[model samples]
Target: MINLTINGFEVEVEQGATILQAAEKIGIKIPTFCYDDRFKPHGSCRICVVEVEGARSLMTACCIPATDGMIVQTESEAVVEARREILDLILANHPLDCLTCEKAGRCTLQDLCYQYDIEETSYDGARKSYEKDVSNEFYTADQTKCILCGKCVYMCSQVQNTDALCFVDRGFETHVGTPFEQGISESTCVSCGNCVSVCPVGALMPKRREKYRYWEVDKVQTTCSYCGVGCQMELLVKDNKIMEVLPVTGHCNEGLLCVKGRFSFDFVSHSDRLQKPLIRKNGELTEASWDEAYNLITSKIKEIKESDGPDAVAGFSSARGLTEDNYLMTKMMRAAIGTNNVDHCARL
Candidate 1:
């Protein structure tokens, strides 16, 4: 264990733990731009710089490991100035379009600027200009809004294992792009949208922005219905309409989702979606109420069981229903209805 003093609070953490992790253990919130739990520590943003008692200069808390008897000042005057200057440099190139930016409500850069009281840019320098690339069906890449934090690049290569994006050019001209600057659709991009989920700014965004803000949506934890794997997902719903589908880290997926799980959710609100139960009446299928449908199904099942014995009745459950529903259907067939011919559409 290593002991460290952060903002006069002495704390102990496991050996080789970063100063940011030590501070986080004590509820000390340190603003970060390039730090993510899933990625290796790449102190590129310099937003979490802090002053150590014996260090030559301010150190990035996200990468610096905690040491025994270390005295760290996360909010010291020098650290504050360094962070302000860093933000100023970032803002000099960043576009001032928060109001119209698709990531306005959920942008980490905007929230950090607000927390640091940075209302205006301190450095007025030439800004990088690049056209928006809407070639990807799932997302748009706007280089002008990118901070070059490399989060998306890391996610693509490390998490998704698809090296579709890379840092192109050098220094001031550096931007995330595909090979030979080709369109996203032309590259090995799978449109899984894992890049957009990790982006801190408006550099990467969904092509179609939802109508509601981030806070306005009700996050409902559910499983993806696209396949039998049933990867967990967070359904962002507003006004009874699904606004977005975010991948949740749990179940079999482990923060990973295929293109179908991430982008093929529009069918939930499709006009052709069935809203009521359907039954075949007079050789034609027609919509029916819940009570009517249940009564008709009950009568049909009872007639079959009595006329041809309960062994002749069969039930085929669906994978679309929950596990409990399938279990109940099996129970009804074997115990109540006296049949052993129950099967699931998914087989397993």
Candidate 2:
């Protein structure tokens, strides 16, 4: 255990805990953009810097270990100034297009700028005018807005293990890109959007699937139905329609999702999708309520059983259904319907 004083409040944290973690434990707000638990802490963004008593300079609270009896000032004058300077530098390169940015409401960098009350950057130098890389179907690679935080780079190499994204070029021209200046779609990139998930800014974001803001949508936590893995996710629904899919920390996936779970959710709100039960009435299929649909199905099954016997009604279960559901389908066929004519769709 390590005891540290953050802004005159003494707090105890477990050994090997960073100062940023300790501050968070005590409900102290320390702004950080590049810090993510899923990846190793590199402290590229020095905005989380704090003043440690007797230390020569401000140290990043993210990567700096919390030492016992260390008095840290998370919001001291010096610390605040240092953080402001870092924010100013980041803002210099970042585009002021938060109004229409897909990540506007959810961007950590946007929140920091508001917290520090910085309307704009002080420096008026050359801004990055990199061409937008929208070749990837899932997301756009906006290098002009990138702060070089390296969170996306870390997530790509470490978490996804794709190593598809890297800091390409050198110094001022350095930008996250694929090998040989190729598009992500042309490279080894899997379009997992894992890097986009960890990105703090609008540098990497899903291509606009829906015209809605973060606050406008209601996040409904649900399990992914792509496969039997049962990865947890949140459906961002707006006006009773699915707008986006956000990954959630659940037992199965741990806040990460594959391409299908992340980006292939447009089918939910797609025009071709069957939104309701359809019943053929007067030679035309019409929308019907659940009760009407179930009643019709029950009546037909009963009529079929009486006229043709249960042998004529074979049950085919879907692979998408749960194991217990598949079992119940077979059980109904054998016990209730008096037939063993049960099979799985996968076999066919």
TM-score of each prediction: 0.88, 0.85
Candidate 1 per-residue C-alpha lDDT over 1-348 given as tens digits, one digit per residue, 9 for 90 to 100 = 878899999999999999999999999988888888787889999999999998999999999999999999999999988988888889999999987787888899899888778887877668899999999888899999999888888889887889899999998899889989886889899899989888899999876656667878899999888665778988888999888888899958888788888888888889998999999979999999999999998998899999999989889988767676788999999998999998888877
What would the per-residue lDDT of candidate 2 be over residues 1-348, giving only the tens digit for each residue?
A: 878899899999999999989999989988888888888899988888999999999999999999999999888899878878888888888889988788889999899889888889999999878889999988998899899999888888888899889889898888999988887888899988888887888888888755888989998998887765678899888999888888998888888999999999878767898988999999999999999999998899899999999898888888767667788998898999999999886776
> 189, model 1: CA deviation in Å?
1.7
Best by TM-score: 1
Scored against the true structure, residue 307 in model 1 reaches a CA lDDT of 93
Q: After the best TM-score superposition of candidate 1, give how far the Cα of residue 82 lies from its true spot, in angstroms.
A: 1.1
List, in order, the clash count of every candidate structure. Answer: 0, 0
Give every collision pair in model 1: none
